[model samples]
Target chain A: MSGKVTNGAGEGTGGSAEGLDAAFFARWMRAAADAVDREADRLTELDSAIGDADHGGNMRRGFEAVRSELDEGVPATPGSVLMTAGRKLVSTVGGASGPLYGTLLRRTGKTLGDAEVVTGEELAGALSAGIDAVAQLGGATAGDKTMLDALRPAADALADSGGKDLRAARTAAEKGAEETTPLQARKGRASYLGERSIGHQDPGAASAALLMAALAEAGGDAEGSA
Target chain B: MADTSEGARVGIVLVSHSKQVADAVSSMAAALAGVPDAPVTGAGGLPDGGLGTSEEVITEAARRVDAGAGVALLADLGSAVLTVKTLLAEGDELPDPSRLLDAPLVEGAIGAVVTAAGGGDLAAVAAAAEEAYSYRKV
Candidate 1:
């Protein structure tokens, strides 16, 4: 469906595309929805340890809304797609993650403007802005043992990779999620647990890694002849 | 009591993770309010009445209660606050003067409604709601 595949001279958005268009973004979202669905149980298990046992159900419901919204018809610009999905998630999820994730995508899409296609750096910059908004809304930073723990490092890796290497971002997100196991949470429900919060990976961070992984998987699929 | 400000009366809003709880709080506030036409409302839970916050319900409740003097919003628990903050960040949906007050649920709702019903301004209503935390029960 995507004829934007490059002819050997890669511009680093991936091996096959000079810049990512709306279709690529749609695929990315679909992949993300799939990952959320696949890992929902694990996320819920993590949440039950230190927080409420609804993280998995909340994420699953949120992404399912996004996926169905896309199924109806993806929006014209990549930004609109994300913006639409963000609104849907916010409206349906009914949890803290709903607003947090909604703000991340909605703010990022807003930053992207109405551009049909955007470079990896542009996406990186927009994503960084989104992450910043999440931090402000949550009032927590990199070491807070929240989604920011995974998302902050993931965004940094994407920026450091010049935004072209979703793989690097994926690795950073997964590693960051894993590293949260030893940290006591300073924000969100887990914070109430205090010392007990340690030894449990944050559910939000785990889901964030799933998101990054889906992005990388989509990038890989786009570069291939599928 | 005569409303010192010329704008519409201040409104009170309560947000909880459960719809029943929010509505009950609103009822309690209304029953003890200082005015006949109390501009107070409560909203919570998802569309299915599940345990979680709803941005749509919050926005709708805020708008419904707003009387131009603005609204003082209070939420229960973590996600409820986060959801309210997200709506505030959007900067458009809710009434411009509406604010998310940092206060306890039942106490804040009752305090905010009483203040607003007595014709308090937006700032006064918010302060009264927030000050609900001061009266500690030992």
Candidate 2:
């Protein structure tokens, strides 16, 4: 889906779009943490139905750790910030989410390289890479009723929009997450429940949607400030 | 029996969802193998003693058990296996000659520890662990 940049080229002198700075990325992480915190109880409730009841707590704790690490000192580049956060999550968070989410951000950040800023198109491509890594690590697909349920659609929307319309990507993720309510989970702990896993929204997918919403909000805020 | 040399022996790592389970299994395996100082490490549960596996814990355990010989990892559950595999892929320390065995946790740990303590190389230890899967008690 990350073929080429199409619209909203930003205000760059060259043909490339304006690069999103490290501050924006940091805000994105902060927003995501806040979203996870807000939805932690609900996430846990959902997980308790078909899987382990630690999704909410795990995500909240991991994001809080990331926030604290960022507070200590924000990195110079967006990629570095994400890389550090990913590493922190990998080390601190337990369960499948730790490695899955950690791989996502680490792979995405690695794709961003050491650049101080990256264009929206570049960010979109990096996000796709990150989602792919998560899928590969977890051995999950779009219909697995895992985080990929939201992430795959969001990544596709972002890439289709050339990373210019964060709101559109957020909407896609929301829809994808909602759609997972009726699917029988095919991966992760929920798979053990068999047919009982159906009719309940996947906690990981729900959280992934929340993350996308936070990213959209951060993107809009950045635009407003600029 | 192999050479029983310090550097030639393989190391074993036991991964489980519960720290207590991992510790017990490691102890049982060591006892069964009759090797007091076998290079066996237990990586289970979260840092907070919760019921889950941690990549950091596994990486640390593997590092501690690796005594110039290679390391073999055996996990009890799906997530545990995934965590260990992820750590092996991403860890910076480079756990060379390390292998993740798809064997039953208790039996595999026992077989692996015995082989490793006997100074079996990486392949031999891994084979011993895998071989445990085929044993029939009946």
Clashes of each: 0, 0
Each model: TM-score of chain B? 0.92, 0.90
Candidate 1 local lDDT, A1-226, one digit each (tens): 2222332245333334457777767777888898888889999999999988999999999999999999999888878988998888888888899999999999999999999888777888999999999999889888889999899888898888777777777888889999999999999999999999999999999999888887777677332222
Each prediction's DockQ against the real complex: 0.83, 0.64
Docking class of 1: high
Off by over 4 Å in 1: A1-17, A221-226, B1-7, B34-36, B136-138
Question: Looking at candidate 1, what is the lDDT of residue A178?
Answer: 96
Give lDDT tens digits, candidate 2, residues A107-141: 98889999987888888899999998888888898
DockQ for model 1? 0.83
Q: Model 2: per-residue lDDT, tens digit, B51-80?
A: 888877788888888776778999997678
What TM-score would you report for chain A in candidate 2? 0.90
TM-score of chain A of each: 0.91, 0.90
